[model samples]
Target: MQINRLFEMVYLLLNKKSITARELAERFEVSTRTIYRDLDILSSAGIPIYTSQGKGGGISLMDNFILNKSVFSEEEKNEILYALQSLSIAQSPESEKVLAKLNGFFDHKRSNWIEADLTPWGSGKDSQSSFSKLKEAILNRRVICFEYFNAMGESRGRTVEPLKLTFKVYAWYLQGYCRTRNAYRTFKIARMSDIVLTEEHFEEREIQGGLTMEDDETSLLSLRLNVTADSAFRVFDDFSETDIQRMDDGSFSISVKLPESNWLIGYLLSYGDSMTVMEPKHIRERLREQAEQIAARYQ
Candidate 1:
């Protein structure tokens, strides 16, 4: 931890030019004595850290000192830039600023080591706008209200304490405390409309284990699907190589784990006659009934 603190102290000096011992202590949540000791450690390590004890004086790095590229190995620097660039994909202005600052620190030109555009094709403009608003609300601890449409096609107004914006499976979701439901809910950004950010701030609540930012890997249902050759392109696009197998008839069999929900049913239906549920009689029956209903309507 001390080693991390020392690195942070150097970064702070590099960014802020100078800071008071009291300020450093408060920033790191350590005592002035501890700050002084860390300064001694930096100075001994030839970091060019110096402190002046007078009015308008504070701890500062030498004006000529530039961070050596060796401090961050080339791979490590690339990783940091890659992370910032990924954040920028969400259209985050702050991420762009920090990314530029970090590049400047290393005296490196912008490198296209990685590019991440998480939005699906034809889905960027709206998703980026929603992500920006949700990110702002989360950072400012503001309450947000939006009209949410559920899978059942019901629309309702929701007031939530925006907690986190997550990018999962090529879509953005807002996980927050829903005042209407009296529980934490994950609202898909695509289904949200009429976004309103309230000026009222909210104190952070202790998050439940199930409702944290991490994705739930449990509760997965194993599904078997038979895909016709006509839809094999769609199959390859959606499924990983390991989850699919080619049959002698030129069809494809896909066995995958997915969260069992209405969304799963809808996703299967979207594939139409080109795909069939090979197992799980209940799911197959449900799909068959839905198809029969549609046929009856046409008849």
Candidate 2:
């Protein structure tokens, strides 16, 4: 912005021969030292300014000094205009305020900032209370209270230290410290309800585990399961793309080591009508036992 102000001062001086630093300092509300430095930078870039030594002394540019195509190439000028135009169309709040300036600058160049805007919520829409509230908590470093419905649909109220806002492949998740669970937990934003910012502030904690911004091979849940082809996609949906793999038999299998958890058994049980276990006998037995309990309930 200071560069823009400097250009404006030089442009105004083009209409006249010279202007004193005192006049510039008064108009710009900056010290005369700053004005002198600005003048040095401008003159070094071939603006052709020199000081006069008299009672009515001031700064003057040579009569033949013309601002032609010496500063920037036509391509470079268009490049700058094109970049500013792109920024004017960004998904931020500042784009609309810049439209007027882009319009004026358009006539000064062959490039134009097109029908672009920066409304993050799109046309005739606004951000939801969930986004607004979560953003507020994150900004203020405050704890939040909300009801979390886990993958099992079990609802629980919690006062957690908000750690990070994560955007998983298909959903937004809040990774935080769960005081109840005594561990870090990830809650899907869509499944969260009645999210409120609490007065209690939270200390910053590093998110030690779960998905990261990078697509590293070691960053995904790499589990090997012997499942039917029908359930392969469903299993892959939980893990990221860099980790999913298909075996030669077209079955639900992974390329890396798997975890031994009850959730794994439940995951296999969902496809009761099709899945089978080959190497993991324990998981298969648990799934069979769970299926029998369901059958007993029906009976």
Candidate 3:
């Protein structure tokens, strides 16, 4: 705690330029003697801190002094600031305050090198609340309950001890221990609703490895597809450039491996007429059947 107080004292001095010992004492709820001791500690540690007894000056750092010189290399300082900046995506107020203070302490201007927002397009307040609550639950080791929809669109209540929140591929997922199934499971955040943070807490568990979108590794499928120029945006967004070949007609040919799941057909169908599967006869037949079902519904 004293170390924290000492760091804050230096931060305060850096920003305020000059403040009396009595002021810091009151702020830290300690005596002016303790403040003087802290100042002495700082001075002995090669911090160019000095106190003045005149009417104007109380305490000040040397005009040319920089904290980075004593504590961190230039690269280390930038890395720390960049990490804190990245954490801004979480919308943490405490991180923001520490970020600002470090920026001032390092005398470095914060650069807008990276911006990250996990909130999806057209998502509402409930989405943000869920994300924040999940983060809190994960950090605090609290159990969470939510209505989760499986790939087949069947919804059921789940009580889970959330371990981690991860963004893989195009979506966010919560990896947790499911109490109902008595196993570790990963749930897509988008399909989760009615999320509740419970007062129950659990000891952290050792995570089993080999987690994947599909539990059956044998279900992985290799496919080749022809994408029209009209779907160029999605082609570039979803596939690596190396995996895509430019055709003579401005269409693209892509070869990629993906997990075979109930939603796989639906995902391919989302490309509509702009894409066609060239390989995998079974998938093509399934897609055609699904299309016929949709047509019958409309008819």
Candidate 4:
């Protein structure tokens, strides 16, 4: 893949000190034009890469430029390698190869200290394919079309310029500019289907804040939840120990801040009777109404 080749090219320039475009092409088994494009990609990403033409001129990084000031330090190098190793769980071939190259460069053997698998439990082949496609679209700045199911169970077609693929909580989200909405929006990858990569390209728009992992202070709701002992495993898994209080009665009480959204409502409802919303009466009432509606449906 071109991404892998681009990474290898950097690694090569680091080790060989310098190399001609033709030599890089031969090494990668690609055309000189393709090699130049790869070099452009590296340069655009702020890698300080440049081409010099003349006697003893070739592709190389800026002299005296280390990968980063801290990158050569053993602890920092291991931290970077560990981060890459975690990212490789997504089955990103480029990241895996880059990790291998970095390991060799640092003369460090790979350690299985950390593992990050973003895919949900029991996720199938389709999930992997969707993730791979989203990654490609985001990288290529390509527009993509897909059918999306929204929170209220409404389905619609969306044409968006894929910008970022985010793995948050237990699901994957795509942050993109939606042509239909004329706004930036986040789409849950699980709710998307028939995803098609369009030939049409979009000018990269500066992404305004849309969906982010950081909780917005203005919209965040401070919550208190009292949970039965039976829900301790779920509570501990989702909340940090600092937010959790073990009650004298062996129950668990958690104080946390969450972004106010319908998803939060559904999440809280998932606990059923095992948990009680101790504060935020509005949220509790909403869940109560929904529970009543669910009971009505069963009746």
Candidate 5:
């Protein structure tokens, strides 16, 4: 925790361009003496920190001076390492480089905290290869071709412009423009049929500040899915939490901005009897036909 606070001080000083010991102590809830002590530590560690006694000057890092990773405490090293390891999987070169730079800061014991190999998704099905190619596409700002299996067990080949990588609800997804559907779409790597990193390039998009998707042609489809209480959480966690409206009898009315594709059909089917199509009579009808066919198979 002390190291974290120290790193916070350095980050703020470098960010603010200038601040007084009084400000640092106040912001960090420490005594002015402690602030001065921190400055001394930075200065000794070659952070180029110094004090000025004149009007409006207190403490500052030199304009060109930089943090030497060698001076980072074990805890600071641990944080940096963890961040870098995550980037490596998300395909962030900057994060991976930070992980490499983190190497300069940590001793052997601290290096253990930066394990990039372990993943929350488990090791079996969607491990290294899936994330590896995704990171590659993101780093290069390129579109990639991948085979995707729709809900009907149909596999389609398509290309997508990888836009941003996201971590939510304990999974990783690539949100991008789906070329075939001509819409913005989010694809989960775990469900990806096969991926082939293409030579085609794409201009990178800015990190959208929040979950709001701009109403655009790429974000075109909207649908209503009627789901029981047990199945609602997955939908809530997938789409905007605000998008879900509750019905009177404890069922759910789920609305989502979906790309135009057969993918929607498969998604609804994944819920099986736990959900039903309410709007877009076409989807509801289609589900009915499929159910009848499946029943006929049993008969």
Candidate 6:
């Protein structure tokens, strides 16, 4: 906290040309004696800070002082600003303040190079609220409770010690220790609801590694599909360019390995008649049966 105060103090003096020790003390909620001590520390650290007792004289940095430009190269300064700019996506006010100060201190204008939004398309405010709450719980090392829905569509109440928030495979997931199951589990954010940040605090656990998506390679099925030209946009959207082969007729052939599951069948059905399963006879059969069931319901 003192380091933060010291850094902000330097920025303030740099911007205002002169500020009273009383002003710095009030700004940082410290005593004037503490502010004087900080001034000493800054001076000892090779900062050109001095104070004059006369009227209109307070704490000031030498007029020639610019945060030693040689300490960070031009590119390094831009990179630092860009990194802080990215944190703006989370709407962190502290980061925004620090970013502004650093921008002025470095005397560099940051360009709008990138934009990121974590909320998915069509998602309402609840999604953003849940993300913010989970982030808070993680930072404070507090337990969280929520209703979670699994792939089978079963809903259950869960009390978890949230460890990390991750984004992978086009979705956000919370990796946490599930008190209900007594083990570590990853819960999809969209499948979570009624989240409550519990008062219970937790100690940091020795997590082995980052979130891992475990799949049995031996059980995976190599899927190949012939997508008509009408679904060309989707083909490129969902599959990598290396996996897609453009056909002479403008249609595309794609090959990928995926686990055979009801979810896979449902995904194929989403393409409707625009896609045909060219291999794996069992998947094709499964798709046909699913289609027939839908038709029966309509009839």
Best by TM-score: 6
What is the C-alpha lDDT profile of model 3 across 1-299, one tens digit per residue?
A: 47658878888887887999888999989999999999999999998998889798799998897766556889999998999888888877667877888887788998967787778899888889999999899888999998987765667899999988889879999898888788788888988999999999999887798554313333678999999998999999998998999999999999998767777898999999999999899999999999999999988
Predicted candidate 1 versus true structure: per-residue lDDT over 230-257, tens digit per residue: 8887987899999999999999999998
Better of 1 and 6 by lDDT: 6
TM-score of 5: 0.48
Per-residue alpha-carbon lDDT of candidate 2 for residues 1-299, written as tens digits (9 for 90 to 100): 46655776676577777789898889878899999999999888878888897777788777887766546765676666666667543332334334344334444533454754222335333335676677668756898888876544567787777776766466677777777666777776766777888899977877777632211212233444555677766767765555555668786554444434444567657767755555456555677788899899998
TM-score of 1: 0.64
Model 3 residue-pair collision total: 0
Question: Residue 134 in candidate 5 has what lDDT?
Answer: 79
Report the lDDT of model 1 for residue 119: 54
Candidates in order have lDDT scores of 0.81, 0.65, 0.86, 0.82, 0.70, 0.84
The full ranking of all candidates by TM-score, starting with the best, is 6, 3, 1, 4, 5, 2
Q: TM-scores across all candidates?
A: 0.64, 0.46, 0.69, 0.63, 0.48, 0.72
Q: For residue 118, what is the lDDT in candidate 5?
A: 31
Question: Compared with the true structure, what per-residue lDDT tens digits does model 4 show for residues 166-214?
Answer: 7776667899888877778888888899999989888987779755422
RMSD of 3: 6.5
Error of 3 at 264 (Å): 2.5
Q: Once model 1 is optimally superposed onto the true structure by TM-score, how far is the C-alpha of residue 13 displaced, in angstroms?
A: 7.1
Put down candidate 6 lDDT per residue, 108-139, tens digits, no spaces: 78677778777889988988888889989998
Give every collision pair in model 2: none
Q: Lowest summed lDDT over 10 consecutive residues: which window, candidate 6? A: 209-218
Please give the ranking of all candidate structures by lDDT, highest first, separated by commas: 3, 6, 4, 1, 5, 2
Q: Point out where model 2 deviates above 4 Å.
A: 1-127, 150-155, 161-163, 176-186, 199-223, 228-236, 240-245, 255-266, 272-274, 292-299
Q: Model 5, residue 253: displacement in angstroms?
A: 2.2
